[model samples]
Target chain A: MAHTPFERIWDRHVVKDYGDGRSLVFIDRHFLQEATSGRAFDRLRAENLPVRRPDLTVGTIDHSISTLPGRTLHSFAAGVARNVAMHKNCADFGVRLFSIDSPHHGIVHVAGPNLGFAIPGSTYVCGDSHTASCGGVGAWAWGIGTSEVMQVLATQSLILRKPRTMRATFNGRLSKGVYAKDMILALIGRYGIEAGVGHTVQYAGPAISALSVEGRMTVANMSIEFGARGGLVGADDTTFEYLHGRELAPKGAEWDRAVADWRRLYDLGDAMFDREIEIDCSTLGPQVSWGTTPQDVIGVNETIPDPSSIADPTRKAMTERAIDYVGLTPGTPIAGTPIDVAFIGSCTNGRLSDLEAAAAIAKGRKVAPHVKALVVPGAAHVKAAAEAAGLDKIFIEAGFEWREAGCSMCVAAGGDIVPPGQRSMSTSNRNFEGRQGPGSRTHLASPAMVAAAAIAGCIADVRTMMH
Target chain B: MEKFTVLTGVAAPIAMPNISTDLIAPSHFPGKKPEEAIVMSFKDKLFANLRYFPDGTPKPDFVLDSPRYQGARILLTGENFGCGSSRETAVWSLQEAGIACVIAPSFGDIFHDNSFQNGFLPLRVPADDIDRLTKGLARTNASELTVDLEKRELRVSGMAPIAFDLPDNRRIPLMEGLDQLRFMLRSADDIAAYENRASTERPWSFAAAGG
Candidate 1:
């Protein structure tokens, strides 16, 4: 039967049936991060279970390594130890690990695709929740839990319940300033984050067609925010081009063969979809999360949100709770809420491009005094590549801390905490209350936007930072 | 690294619903290095106060470090335990604290898998059965409950049995101390065969050739 990339990947990795509700999927590729796998590796030795399929897995340290300029092993000792442990765990499991020293190492999400670990018509799993990022390459990738980590380590298979399917189509061209992130945030706004619970979503449309691979990754990575099982895109020229010559990609005549096969990974003319959402991206923009959830958001030009304006009681209640906690009021514009901190990295948008964008904004501009900002490199290689171009120095000269490559404030790990009651703008995927630190309010934005916020000490339009 | 222990007990006794992983282990750590920075991120940032971070104050609504269950072994929780992000650290932190198993009406899909693989028996019991234990605790103001991991049964002291769902594949693996990663690594020969074949069939797949 003809199939889309999602269907092809699904069929190849299916191992068993768990009734109609669920099926067993054999993992084709597995990725591990420092935060999740450290203990899991220890568990395997304790249980005497070897991390099987070491050849199918890879590791990279991103979360705790600082993004500060002149990031040295001697400076961030705790973070350095985590990277060391990640390297150790990968070695123990026989999975290839990319360390701080590896030029290829960066955010695992970006690193995996850049290294071509995520292939068309395949299955992938990662210890990181944003493993969905692999979907950008047309793979059926999903995040796994620690216990699942143990299971994957032992068997490289997962018994997964089939999530209901949703086909979200983005037709029409996206207007300027509107991004894939804005498109997703807008979709979630229409269908609350939980709308797609227990379902897989297919991003199809002219708008999706227009997105860069990184933008597609941004779209898919937020699938979890809406509680979806996963998100996927069909393979096309864009997909193949991104994979072309990647460090771990197919080479020479074999590359031609691979492309020929990948080109076929798209929906047949009469393909079926369980549900559909058509979004006109002509009005999307620099989106900002206004409330606690990804769904609770507004366009960058909108206000802080008036809970009373929402019709749904649940939404209203949620907004009320968020407004009370975030210290925002109705009729107050969200674009200038005043931030005390600003961050520009995470699995969602912490790519080299993101750093470049943020640095462009901070190149000659200075960070606001009250805003203690940090520009974290999602991966070590990203750190190095940026520094090779002296991006780190620009951030530091502008008062931004260039720290290690581990997940920092975005996850609250490695002592990366934003003080409570402090409002800040971040580029991470989630803006859940206290997700950064206890009572620390986070408003998610793009890297450039985050840099703009750092400069203004509050939410500001990226377009305004053009100078 | 010091070894984590499993608590041997008779029955489960948590009373809340939707015991999320954020409560078990939040997604504070997402990178490969930086283990130390992550482990202590929420040590004092109790579940209740996760909403008020950076203030370093507890909201008191979180249950991770509540006084009521200070020394409890079997975590009898509400439905959908670990229902959040797929953070394995949650399982590690719980296991490190000697929580051998978590008995709830349901568990988050990823968390359940992580828990089982990490040697944490996430027992899925009926809501009614869980209610019975909750009521018993409420009446007696007691929270101590035991779960027998080997038998896959939950029995309160002097109380009748409370049945729980156990993934069939997990039975022997948990008992024999096996996990998917470990199992594959053990069958290096089989994995190598698959890798070699995958490379030959799809020579373009770098991961296959690298393996």
Candidate 2:
């Protein structure tokens, strides 16, 4: 019987099946960040359980670190102590850590993949919802909670029930200004957020194949937003090309062998999936979230949905609450909605290509006087590459603050936040209540869309500014 | 983790959909030290935004604040409760606030997994059962409900008992207060054998940690 990519990878990782629904699955790589790993490490020490495999684990400082210029350990007083705790924990546990001063330090999800730690046909785990971003390389990656993190630290294995499989095929060619961010948002908007629950989604078809590795990461990063624990894109020539010369990637003869093995990681023609859905990308427009939930999204040309028109009582109530919280009227058009801030960075869209796309729009243009715009690279290497490509100057000249690498503004940590009751155009994944800060409303969009909105001082269509 | 074989207590209703973990445990809590927040009891921080004013006074209108549901141990809410973010702090806060079970049509996948690890029951009953329970509680002014894990039954004041399904693996752990890590460690030999075989089969996976 032919097996799908998810099945093949999952079957390879099972150490033992308990005859019940649970199975002991092996974890290939584990990435840790400051905020979630401190308690897990403390617990490990308290229990006198040594890390099962220190070589398979790596840590980075990202979640709570400041992104301001000349940032030091003491830049953010609240985060300083946590950073100290993380350093001590990682040192005591014999795990390699990329501290705040390290050149490789960045968001774990971003830096892990960029460093070639997430290889094809491997299993990766992190204590972050966006760990699925590493699945761009065809790895079986998912996020876990703190307790599960402790489990990984002590045992390097987790007892997990196999999830059902779903194949989401994006067919047809993407239109200009429409991107992976738009594609994923359109999917969540059409299908409710719970559509991917109880399943691992495999993103396939022509559109997925055409996306760059970074673009694929952007789509997979939001898998948690739609309630999926994991999402993967099968490895191909494009994936191998992206991994070829990366730091932790296999060397010479080993690289050739790795590539040959990765080539077999795709699904066979007769592979089976529990559920399948196809989405057409030819007619898709740039997407922007208008409400708290990612499912509450619309195309750039569409208007905000009215709660009264919704039939389901639960949906109607949710919509009404979202609209009230976001401070938007039911029938108002989403395009002209004013925004007080424009942020372009996160694990979702903080890569080099994302910065280039945003910079392309910001070049030869000035941000509207009222909008406070900033661009934060996802990783230190990404920051260096963007600066080498002259993207930083373009953004700075366009009135967008070019900041250090971190998860700035996206999580409202390290003192970077959108003020209360103000609206922001952000490239981050979640737009839940006070996600960016207390009472701060966020509109999720692509990096290019955020750049256009920053220039226009409102939610604007990126296509209009293109060319 | 506490054992949760059975629970009988007041169930409060909050009829909002997609109650994200961010709402349950906000990232920013004034006057709380960041480093100590993780180990501290989040009882007062549960639903801080919705439950408190800017000046730090409790909002009396919030469901958990209402005098009738002050000690509620079960939460009856809409679909997709505990959605967004994999922060286990959300479960910790709810547990600290005296909530032992949450009855919703569905829950976020990560949050569901986190609940099992903490011995908290995230029960998924049909929408009709929730509707019936809400109406029954309102009509009779009897908010007490019993969740019997052994029988897999939910009993309310006036309605017929509703049966729910939980996997045996998850159910057994919660019933016995078993430590999953300790249990998995018992099979260390199996894990070692698997790893050795995997290293030979996929040598690329064990390559150096850094570039």
What docking tier does model 2 reach? medium
Residue-level lDDT tens digits of model 1 in B67-118: 6666556676665566657876677666666567777766666676667666
Structural similarity to truth (TM-score) of each candidate: 0.80, 0.97
Please give the distance, in angstroms, between residue A171's alpha carbon in candidate 2 and its true position after superposition. 1.0
Give the alpha-carbon lDDT of every model.
0.70, 0.88
RMSD of 2: 1.7
Q: Which 10 successive residues of model 1 chain A have the least lDDT summed?
A: A66-75
Tens-digit lDDT string for candidate 2 (A287-328): 999999989899988899999999988778888989998999
Which digits, one per residue and each the tens of the lDDT, describe model 1 over residues A331-395? 78888888998988887877777888888889888998899998877776677788899998899
Query: What DockQ does model 1 achieve?
Result: 0.27
Score candidate 2 by DockQ.
0.62
Worst 10 residues of 1 chain B by lDDT: B1-10
